[model samples]
Target: MLNNYPLLAKVESPSDLRKLPRQQLKPLADELRAYVLDCVSKTGGHLGSNLGTVELTVALHYVFNTPEDRLVWDVGHQTYPHKVLTGRRDRMLSLRQRGGISGFPRRDESEYDTFGTGHSSTSISAAHGMAMAAKLKGESRKAVAIIGDGAMTAGMAFEALNNAGIPHGGLMGDLLVILNDNDMSISPPVGALNKYLARLMSGNFYTAAREGAKSVLKNTPLYEFARRFEEHTKGMVGPGTIFEEFGFNYVGPVDGHDLESLIPLLENLRSRPGPQFLHVVTKKGQGYKLAEADPVKYHAASGKFDPAVGFVKAATPPKPTFTQVFGEWLCDMAEQDAKLVGITPAMREGSGMVEFHQRFPTRYYDVGIAEQHSVTFAAGLACEGLKPVVAIYSTFLQRAYDQMIHDVALQNLPVLFALDRAGLVGADGATHAGNYDIAFTRCIPNMAVLTPADEAECRTALTTGYQHTGPATVRYPRGAGVGAEMTKPLTAWPWGKGEMRRHSARPQTHGRGTPRIAVLAFGPLLYPALKAAEALDASVANMRFVKPLDLELVVELARTHDALVTVEDSCIMGGAGSAVTEALSAQGLTLPVLQLGLPDEYVEHGDPVKLMSLCGLDAAGIEKSIRERFLSAPLLRSVANE
Candidate 1:
């Protein structure tokens, strides 16, 4: 159940928020923080980011004229508060559900969501484009890009700042970049501006004089003196000088948690001209004590749990997840070889490299939020005769497509890419779904694209890929395995090979001879294909390798069966199913093929189990689809006569 916040419950939209008195805004932010923790504990979404952005979200909405003035949220993980203030408060209960609102911002969902974003560091670019568009059209509207410190490390964010440095009208104006600096580890400001801004923001006299101070500084020679003073004071302490060189008027290291301070600063910056960079300092999980201590663990939440007690690590362990399986295998592999290196793009926790990093800190490399660098960096390590295993998500790997192809595949480097979350990622939806990796990786030269059926096979796939003398990928689905036990010892599977999961003795005909049918499945889809095969009395071939399709098995099976049906968790177009067809076509074999996978359209957010059945990849849906198409009267008539 969604918790009702007295102040927050009253405000239906940003217009309602603007109506509240300045004093009530503090109480409203407090209520909003509690409400997010309450709703997310029940429904479960991005918690740490939303908790961190509560005050900032309130301050921005209260100051700016949104809908008219566009605000782009980078990555959209911290948008729970933004969603609440923009007429989606009631929809918070159904957050990331099938027919409800998305976890990330969607253009179709609302006009407030200026640009749909799930990937990081595109906010500045999108907002800058909007500012230029507004300037060209002669509209008096501002565009602000709210980005996190992690997101700013991305090359795209820096590129956008560079682009905005030289604005459309040949002067720095309109575009505002609000860097939400939650990470306290990044060299903080030791100067008076931190205290100066904080003290000035607290009082009404300074807030009143802030607008006039801007005019005097812009017109008079005192402007350069004030700039020099700020530069000399916070040059080394803060990252202001770096942004200043990028042609932005940098202001802050301000108190983001204090509504009294953040609100007044936002009001002043609202009217200020030129490329303004406001660096707000806030803590992840500010209000909640337990979450504040360990923000990463509380980054996302699920089911009911009191904010007081917090998330107690589940004692009675459930099934081993695919991620956990990889983590265990990585440590084992690393222990066996000193030349082994593990790399992640700011996903030390998500990519299951925690233990690997802890055990071998020297070998573990967190390249921050730069995926492109992570891939090319691995190529460099492999060039120096070291085995580098890149632990990256299937969705994030999209950002480093060039490095994967040019640096790794082109040179035929011995780099293993462990692409976690390889199928439909449920609540994360289309933006995060890893449906294209199979198609994308298979097409590249010197790339071994392998998919594992269960937890046991996942470990083997990783081993098989790591030992291979070329660029190899082992893509696995998110969440726990299908009650499959993982092997203690590590071993590599045979290269470019697949095994028969289920084989029916003969084709079932209603008192007549009928042609046999076979289902060729890749990865997790093999379970459902096996289930569907039982009903049809068909054989199930688990084709693990996508690029090197087991031609020997496929040719023999095609000759035995009249119709061939291929199934995968990825998209039907150019997916593993297409690989089977291409192999058959090369040998001039005219086998009737049916391909089943995620359709042409993007799959929406929901429970992964439910989404599977909806996509016709589950047992019942797979059986119904197969029997309806392949088991047709006309197609099987010639075989039935035999």
Candidate 2:
């Protein structure tokens, strides 16, 4: 595969790429694009965004001294082309695999990856900081932020733009903010207006002349007319007037794929001073025909696929995902109650609100990439006596914690939080993992947290949370459960109560009076704990609620069993396990308690099954841990003697 692209094979790094003739860059970009498609077909990663950034990635590395001049990418999914050029070409095959390179950029992975990113709308602030740091250190290097049009929807990007445009205490960094406008709304087809104006704005002659004219015509009516005329001229052609007000020299909505246009424009902008904005037009899935037609379907390939034929649906449909269960529940609930409304923070597809949106268009709200706003907006709706359900990923909900506390929970409003992906997420790594929600949400007063075990239970949990009078959360894992039947009616489960799935059959006392063990599992880990209970003869309780936490069940199990073990999929510290331990402390019961969950460290990207096994949360691992902790050698012999 490497040999197929001879030009790309020769480029081990950007240093080697700089040695190539300027005429060879176009051929190299073509080869690079082909290689990305091939590699992604085999490995399965971000497809559309990476395909869109090929030429831009090539031109940036060619024009700027990258490692020294920092290039920070927002939402690093589109950095596949950047990875290939920055000496990570061979590692493309190992993308998102265990013990391999990450799908997103990592600070520890490469020096060229100046900042790590996965969540959107952070590049502007980070790049401006780098530029200011370079200026403070007296370093002559540029700092560039390559942000997408979708990322620009967040308010944080504008906050950084508002600050970066002005000089900080008479000191400004050499910064460039490249808005990769792929939406195609503001930008029409590129023509003479785009190319000529982009080149003109980047030139030193125009910069000097504009400054000279202002200096000579100051305190005169002509100067005011000239300023308005310039702003209006740029405004009529493109969205440049807004950035000009932010104190940056605004350039054209140029064609990003045109290396000839991008290279010279970048070369000129690199030499310019203060802050500058370059609007480059690109398209998601630019080179691939199928992906270009439907970018959403091809956003990220799930598994290996034939590049020629593209992705094919399995003949036998797969089991419904957790998101699908939630979507169906939302529609069913909405049909029953007219006041029920569904909301998501730009994750309508990922959160499984498409069907709900189609059926109840008036009740479904897709707030654009604004998590904080979504929470407060839901609060406002709840205040009007309308039940608002926020279906969001657990990681993204972290961005709206304060809003959840002050706006919803503090006011004692009736808002339900349907948190999906509430555990270790594979491939996306620690940045996207929903490991801390349980720990964080349980601490707040008036917040009830529910951990459902299976698909059927997840639906019931949604109903339970929705029917509650105060703020409540129903968190479930990312993928499907253990094929549990979903035939039950949409109704709430008994409030804060847990059911015993399996009980130890052996006698309570043996020859040496060995104490019996009981396992309290919260969430999907209940399934694995059940398997482990078979081997250890331990009683398993599917602890449904993490907050109210079935205290009666805890005391009953504690009094009956000799040792207690708490299990969850969240962090071990300050998680459901900590809740159980705290309840025991409040009851003044002293017993052998073992806490099992995610370790106090960041788990990397890999297969979810393997990651769970590594964390000692699998069936075999759970059995081994229980035996080692409670059923020691002498106690095991005593039990076997019976």
Candidate 3:
């Protein structure tokens, strides 16, 4: 379908896009959007954000000398169009798949992706760094950061603005900060700033002021002075007024979709000196009627569907995602326990807390992309005897590590952390992967971590974490579980315990003629481990607890098996495998351990199986690694000989 557009299909690079006539740009954008929708529908990635940025992306690449003039995309969810235009058109189908282009901008992936970004609100800071570096090196390269209006709510964006506003060493490098106002960040963006900006941009005061200033300036003898005065007057009128205070030359409330307006404005800004701010208004799903009407539903989609009817909802037995499970648990617990409160950092919809917010508005707090504040806020609520359940992604929680340790763990605050996406999150790639949460959280004192093997266990774990008195985390993987019947009634499992799901018949090599070689799996990845174990003729243990080590099970398994393999969907370093090794070492038991998990390097975005295999966490990979570690090379043989 995209090949039909000669202007688009012929353009392999941004340089090619720059040569196209202004009149043809809209058709090119249309083709780009169509191509994105088609590709994402098949691969399933961030759809709505990319669809929205199609024009903006084309305009940016066309205007800027990319690979030299750095364009840092905040959050990078909107970088799909950027990727497609930047010589990655042919490989678009392989996006977010293992060994393919990442869903988010990756510096390693392409030179055009000057800076890698996954989390929100980092673009300004990154652009500031690039701008500063260019100034220091005496280079004339421009640094432009395109951030969404939703991302602007983040504290880091403002912090970067404050820094960029300050003149550095008497040399002011050009930093163009384009605020792509889509008016939605995952959910309808929250906070006073978002509301204030929305109102200020929409108001007719700017229009009236500009018209009045033009008439007065044209008639007056002091034209330059009047123009300066007019600009100064504009500072008090609208949203750009606030940015002007931050020491930037404010431009626009321009139509982002209009190439005629956007191109000239960008050209003017490109020639200007110092920090320039452009507030471009854009729709979340521009062009596509269905997506435009309901952006949130199509925020990220699976792949090509009937644009007329929109995305085809996957027909499945109505089952809850881990996020839904946590959301339901929070509301259910809150209904019974008045002290139970819910907290999220600008992820109300993603974390599945929208219904909870509606039901318990007073008790639910959306902290607006402030992870650090969310953790500390939970700590404060905990101090006051209110049980605060922080529903955060494993990747996002990394932002508040100090707060988690100092505010919650050190003080032993009863903050139940419902960690969603606690494993290799497919498509979103390395940046969004929840691989390090287990390693980091488990090391903290007075911290408890639980991993659910299935959907039923996920519900139980959330309740279990909620009932606990100190800092606790119930980490669950992304997506649905292995069709296990979900049980009602929040039954609490014993903390730091493991359940043997299946046992081996033959005495494994690890045990003296005993069926002992066992696979200890954590989180939802346990299903694959169990399946692999069945083929390997080894025991499978659902090690529900990550922290506290499940010592009893560990000791028993150590005594029974000569070799033990720990498998998890997390980083091997300082993770489940490391925990098991620590436990066994403390007991003075020396067992050959084979750790099967995500590697030290970042795993690229792709299919879950492909990612797992790449990281040696898949069924075949796990079996092969274990067999190689235990059977192929016996360390005990060499030790005995020595």
Candidate 4:
């Protein structure tokens, strides 16, 4: 599929790549860079991060013998180039599509992908484990973890580093950590370490010694003296004594884009012993001119686009996304309540808090990539009587579930969790899907989980969650809602309630007698269930609350209808549908319940609508499933009565 990459075409795997001359590696990197842009542009995916890691990825695969020696990538969105070079060049066109190559590093997909990572900052721990395994086996294999500065912001990175860098570490040696410091994440990275790294660029002695050492002293023990001198001088005089104190040799402040610099340094680090940290600097969106100029816009590159023309706005006014609707509500809510404060785990952009940040700069807190810290941090704010609204994706929020339970829920803190990306997140696939949120959050005590059906309801739910005395969460899907006209003057909707949308119990059917089925729809699946209910002549209720779950209405519906069908855009296991069954059982209520949701297996990446249809969550699929599963019981009853 990548047609014109002559140098890249030769590299079938890391073995063929190792055979190439050192001088040709740069050219190969160039070819790989071009190919990545071409591939991702055609099929929309992570563009800028992959562009940044071109030479670094090439240099790592080139220097190290992969499959035997592990190369772990942290927050594996930057692995497109790595995927291309490592035996998946032909299948590059199928990246992120259903039944094709995964966007992240999947261990099942390739032997070269030593560890799977979609979330951030687990690379060090995984790579270090491999190193320890090699040591235990008495093998000479090496392990390298390529982690970005953004990933380093997570508490786990330091936890791994703290253990890996200690003298008594189980396996401290032969482990190399290549810090890919691009100075940019999805949102520009924040924290003290970012400031520390920004200042770490000032030391000039390491670069000078690296460039001038071997050439200047080609004669004697002085050459060894110079190399030792570089370390001693840097530790004593330079700013990187922190790594030295941690018991690992620190290298670089080197150019990550320059293959000449990266290749030799990597080769040297590979031969050495003990944990080595190499900090290489590179620009995000390095090769592509358009992406380089505006990396954030080209982050995912959105849908298919002509790379030459770049991103273009559609002529017609686009529908506001669920994120945008949340943003509007957030801004309005902040204006109304003085105690309102916004917090995100390095997701200010993705969580629809850009305008909220601008308007309430003093109240906005970007807590780096630390999701655990974000949840606990919100609890701290809530203790002071401030209403802290945590803007987070449902999947990412899983990282801080313990904190959600212990810090907020147990204590009954009034922290509003505005959970964005609450359903199948489409192209990002199962790792990022909000399918588990309903299941995960509903089980926690003192938590109100609200899922909005439309944009207008999304706004009302936020207001309601804000007004609630304890921890409340609003779960919504990823993109635009079914165009509901937003109302002004923020108003709180009734808490723990559901409304009947359609009531057609025992209505006249075309042929045989119809089934008495009550379609209790949860979250955004209300529309689809409505359509399914129409043909079946069943009653439909829009159950807005997953928790405190409209118990009265649910009991009444179960008593009235012969069968109850619960529909949600989440996992069937421990989800809202499960809650319905549990609620029915608790109240001495017995009903034939059909639970329809995401299956036990992980859903693959593709078009959202198509994936939903495939998962049997769409209108047609829901209708077919309801008819087959529940309608049969009523049909049998009618035959017996007849």
Candidate 5:
């Protein structure tokens, strides 16, 4: 691979990259872009975004004194080229694997990775902090934030822009914000800002005239006046006016892929002072024709595939994902109920709402990358006697916590939150993991939290939550469950109730010299727990709802058995396990309770099954834990004697 591109092969680090002559950078970028596509194809990670940022990455490293000068990447999926140049080229094969490199930037990963990020619209604020720190310490350092056009839709990005553009205590910091306007953010960009940027890109006359006037009028008395006039006129005509209003010296609508254009502009900006904003236009998939044509499809690869042919359909039809089930249910429910409306925070495809959007355009709302607004928007819809189902990722719901409590739950609105990716999302790692939703939402008043056991239950849970007058959440993990039968109708489950799936074969010996143990499971982890139960001959109960837990069943299981075990996919501290312990304590029943779930520490990126096993949530792991905690030699000997 190295022999294919001599320039890229020699560049082990950014310092090594800098050693190459100026003319060699174009070839280097070409090599880097090709390498990114190659690596992502093999490893199954982010593809289009990485391919887009090749020249920009090369230019930034070439121009800036990184490690000393901080570069914070917003929506860090585009950092593959950055990673490749920063002494991790060889490790590209290990991307998102167990003990391998992360898909996004991690502060601990490298000195070049100044800020760790997984969510969008955060780069500007972090870079501003770094820039301000440099000012306070009196260090000659610069901070640059590279943000995507899609990320710019979020209010947080603008909030940072508002603050960063001005001075603190009458002192300014050297900060630069580069808008990598690929016009894509997982999904196609939306909102007024996207339109405004489109206009900015098309307003070539304003950009050309402004620059032409500046160059020709320099050293003349009218130059300063012309500059002021340019700013004033650009406000009405288009181009840089909005950014200039924020107090930054706005530059470009430059070619991001062209090394010649990107390098010189970046070099000039590197020497400038105060806040600077550069708008660079680039393609999502620059070199690859397939991805360039259909960026949304090639946003990220699910697994290894042939790059030449692009992604092909599997030979066998795969099991339907929970996301797909939700999408299908949403359409079916919408057809029945006129008030049924679906909302997503710029995740039309991710939450499986592409078909819904296609079928019911008026009822679908894609509110860009604003989680806080999505919840409040749903609440407002529900206020008008409409049933709004906010289809969002479980990790993203954390951003709208206050809105969830104050707007929806407080008002007791009929708003159902269909939270996808409810547990340890493998490749995206700890940042994208949905480990805390069960713990967070269950505590809120008027909020009901449901953990469905499988695909069939997921559909039922969704129906139940949507029908409830109060705010409710139904969280399911990413991808397919155990291929459970999902042929059931969209009927509501018994409210806040659970049913025993398996019972102990032995006679009920009420807590006296009995080795009988009962395992209560939540969500899809029930399947694994059932497998574990088979070995131990333990009773298994699918505790459906996490918030209004089945206390009656808990007490019954506790009284009949000598010990009880709780299993879930979320964090053990405040998860389903905690609910069981609390229920037992309230009922004044004490039995040995073993809680099993994700640990307190962050679980890094890996294969989902491997990660579950490592966390002791898989069948083998669960059985091993139950055996160690409950089925000791003394207990086994006593059971043998009985």
Candidate 6:
């Protein structure tokens, strides 16, 4: 069944795949799925969803003339097969590795990646834009968006569909949207709409009756009348009742894993016109037995492991990640304070709030994939004098920027934002990196931002944020911290002040400056900064607060030190570095300042160490950059002296 396909290995591009015989497509799909499983088993990535979409990706690429025909993938976690087929198979081994291929569709990476996607439910809007652009240029190229059923729950997806349904300047363009329904998000999708859609799609009688009526109606003399009757019948019986109202020609609940079904259906849709929606049913981890049995656990993975026993849990010294620390602290805080509530936008496990949800059922809210709602919900809770702790990823929180500014910050609500995965997140790539929170949060009027370098600091920061009356965010990175001993209950640290790890003694400038070159480090990057400082014989301060500026420390460092360097695992632009710059400007202290952090460009996926090095956030990289900047200072001083 898998023989006689020259296009399988010969294909260097999507165009090459398009040249194959239609009958051989099934074999190609099989081969592609196998290849994906092999690569993921070795490298470890988003396995389940990609396994499910192998046939769908093949079918779309085969039918569509990509590059010209824009295909925007929603969420992009499932784009492994798409990447492999689109002239990136050679680099598949290096998937999610630093300075290698990204896990998501990056516009800068290739022409095939028409739109960069990391967050969910964006494909339709992006594709709509592309379609509109094509129409404006008088270009006949097709624009297709492949989004998951899970992503469909997001308000943005519906908003896009609503806009796409309207005629383009009163004229609708050719845009095909494929809904890949795997019946699950990272966790099983929640909400009434999800349940309603699942029932409508999975109900055997509903599907059979709809298809049977259509089949009989096509043969009848009253076929047009029967089709209209069928549409009315569907409105009464079906749930995409809402989608029809959105002005889309809804097709299928079709078998997505079946290429025979998908290819013909895609071809038929391709021939037709105006905003097409195909609801294709697929299982996450369709081919892989182990993953199919347990989709959520295997949604995404890391490192090499045996397929037989499944992913082996690596044996290590017992130490909690910053996420786990936050989760424990949140639960403990909730136990102590009855008014404390928890909120997460579809990140139960990722944020480590599973136990909290179980223990405090009334207070915990999983607001689906709606980040905007999550923030506003927390704000509403805070309005009632209830402390709402929003446990969200730094990247995901970007979606709720307006809500954070307008609702939480403006109102000065006591909402504690537990920002997990705050720094360079390994494997998940640029989309998942929480690099901009420091800059974004600090800019807000009533917002206070704190970063925890170690596990203990994470717990303290959470307590500090919770105790604060205004909007506060405690940002921490992914993975294990420096394994600091977790001994006590939650305790609030001094607000807006920093802890000095080392004291200088050169002169009594601002404070005594004996050591010189005060290195202000924030978040998980502090470990490397400390190591670098030891090497350079410099003073170090765990500048815990991103906002409030640590005024006293800044003034002292500026007065005493010949040079000062600010280090953080966030974007240098408008980040922790920017915060320090703003603070120094306010003080009118212009001592040689070096801002070291993540660069302006997006950090790619790889091992955390490699990614840090690439962004100059590593110990060696940070020290070298600081050394180079200081080396240039002497020349400037000579010019000043002249």
Compose the digit string of candidate 6's lDDT tens values, residues 1-642: 124434467778898888888888888888888887777778888889999998899989998888888999999999998998899987888888777788899989889999999999999999999888888888888899999977887899999999998886766878988888898332232334443443454345555676687788787788888766656865543344567678776765666777766676677677655787777778989888888999889898767777667887668655778888888998899889999989999889999999999999999999889999999988888888888999999999999999999999998989989998887888887789888898889889999999888999888888988899899999988888889988677788898988888765443232223325778988877889888887777788889998877889887776667668899888888988777878877866666668898888866678887778877878999888877776434413212211
Instruction: Select the stronger candidate by lDDT from 1 and 2.
Output: 2
Deviation (Å) of 129 in candidate 4: 0.7
Ranking by lDDT: 2, 5, 1, 4, 3, 6
Q: Compared with the true structure, what per-residue lDDT tens digits does model 3 show for residues 1-642? A: 555667778898988988888788998998899888778766778888888888888888888898799999999999989998998888888887777788888887899999989999999999999999999998998999999987887888999999999888897778999999886332232334443443343335644675577787786787778767755665443356678779887765666777766776677778767898887778887878888888888887755566667777678665667788777877788888999989999899999999999999999999888899899999999999999999999999999999999999999999999888888888787788899999999999999999998888988888888888899998988887776777767788887778999888866453333334878898877888887887788888899998877899988887766678899888899998999989888877887788888888977777776777777777888888877776665345213211
lDDT of 1 at 266: 71
- Supply the global lDDT for candidate 5: 0.88
**Clashing residue pairs in candidate 1 (N, C-alpha, C atoms within 3 angstroms):** none
Ranking by TM-score: 2, 1, 5, 4, 3, 6
lDDT of 2: 0.91
TM-score of each: 0.93, 0.97, 0.89, 0.91, 0.92, 0.88
lDDT of 3 at 178: 92
- What pairs collide in candidate 4? 173-274, 174-274
Q: Which scores better on lDDT, 2 or 3? A: 2
- Candidate 1 wrong stretches, greater than 4 Å: 1-4, 169-173, 187-230, 507-513, 636-642
lDDT, residue 485, model 6? 87
**Who wins the lDDT comparison?**
2
Candidate models: Cα lDDT each:
0.86, 0.91, 0.82, 0.85, 0.88, 0.82
The sequence of per-residue lDDT tens digits that candidate 1 reaches over residues 354-402 is: 9999999999999989999999999999999999999999999999999
Please identify model 5 stretches exceeding 4 Å from their true place. 184-228, 235-238, 508-514, 633-642
* Per-candidate total of colliding backbone pairs: 0, 0, 13, 2, 0, 11
Per-residue lDDT of 538 in model 6: 77
**Positional deviation of 394 in candidate 2, in angstroms?**
0.7
Query: What TM-score does candidate 6 reach?
Result: 0.88
lDDT tens readout by residue for model 2, 1-642: 787999999999888988999999999999999999999998898999999999999999999997888999999999999999998999999999999899999999999999999998999999999999988989999999999988888888999999999998899989999999886867788887788888988999999999999999998989999999989988877889888998889998999999988998999999998999999999889889999999999999988999899999999988888999999999999999999999999899999999999999999998878899999999999999999999999999999999999999999999999999999998889889999999999998999999999999999999998999999999999888888998658888899999999999865653256668889999999999999999888999999999888999998987777778999999999999999989988987767788999999999999999999999999999998988887774443223223
Clash count for candidate 5 is: 0
